[model samples]
Target: MNSKIYFDGSIMTAELIGEIDHHSAKNARMEIDALIQQKKPAELRLDFSGISFMDSSGIGLIMGRYRMMLLYGGVLRVVNVPHDLERIMILSGLGALDIFERQGEVYECT
Candidate 1:
């Protein structure tokens, strides 16, 4: 999998591409975590629109990032999740995490 990260003010957006599985999860997590630490953004927006497949490792990835963001008093938001992936997220209890359908909008955490 590939990822592109950009910042919108204090929000760090990671646009993920390709498939997310055990093979790619570690590297992807490291890359995204480094960027997040560098930016120290108030939110981490994970855009999964370009992802065609994702397995359980994907769930771990999101959860890891979610916890990391919380350490900085930030939040994680998942965007543009596909139907199939959404099921996996739900089954994995990732649905309990903050998720959204739109990209590029600003989110303020209270």
Candidate 2:
């Protein structure tokens, strides 16, 4: 897996690439968590624009980050989710999360 992270004031955005299955969850989690801890950003925007696949571990990853941000009095958002993963997230009840449409798109999860 590969990731690019950027911080704009209190908002931190992470653009993740590749599969987000069991094989990559740990490393991905560690990488993002480290940055979150260091920055303590008020908002985390996870950009899945480059992701090709994601399994249950992906849900876990999002849930964990949501909890972390909640604890910090912050919030988390997922963006640019592919169709397949969007189905998975819906089935997994992850649609309750704050998910936006593709990059620069106006649609968003309520």
Candidate 3:
């Protein structure tokens, strides 16, 4: 998997691409974590639009980033989730975390 990271003031967005499996998750984690540790942004957004495939590791990635963001007193948002991947994320209990902000549906974070 590959990720393109963007920074806009206090918000950092990581646009994830390709397959997110156990092998690729580590690299993705490290890349994002490095930036988080350096920038300590107020918000982090994970963009899933370019993702072609994903497994449980993808969920782990999101959960891990969520925790890291919380530690930094920042908010995490999962955006542009494909329909199929959205189902997987919801089934994995990610839907309950208040991290998703789909195109047509909005999830309130509280």
Top candidate, metric lDDT? 3
Q: How many Å off is the CA of 50 in candidate 2?
A: 0.5
Cα RMSD (angstroms) for every candidate in the order listed: 4.0, 1.9, 2.3
List ranges where model 2 is wrong by over 4 Å.
99-110
- Runs of candidate 3 exceeding 4 Å displacement: 107-110
Backbone clashes, each candidate: 0, 0, 0
What residue pairs clash in candidate 1, if any at all?
none
Worst 10 residues of 3 by lDDT: 101-110
For candidate 2, the per-residue lDDT at 107 reads 38
For each candidate, what is the lDDT? 0.83, 0.85, 0.91
Residue pairs in steric clash, candidate 3? none
Write the residue-wise lDDT of candidate 1 on 1-110 in tens digits.
99998888998889999999999998999999888888889989899999999999998998899899999889888887776676777778655554544546532221
Give candidate 1 misplaced runs (Cα > 4 Å).
100-110
Candidate 1 residue-wise lDDT at 56: 94
Whole-model lDDT, candidate 3? Answer: 0.91
Q: Is candidate 1 or candidate 2 better by lDDT?
A: 2
lDDT of 3 at 99: 84
Q: Estimate each model's TM-score.
A: 0.88, 0.89, 0.93
Please give the ranking of all candidate structures by TM-score, highest first, separated by commas.
3, 2, 1
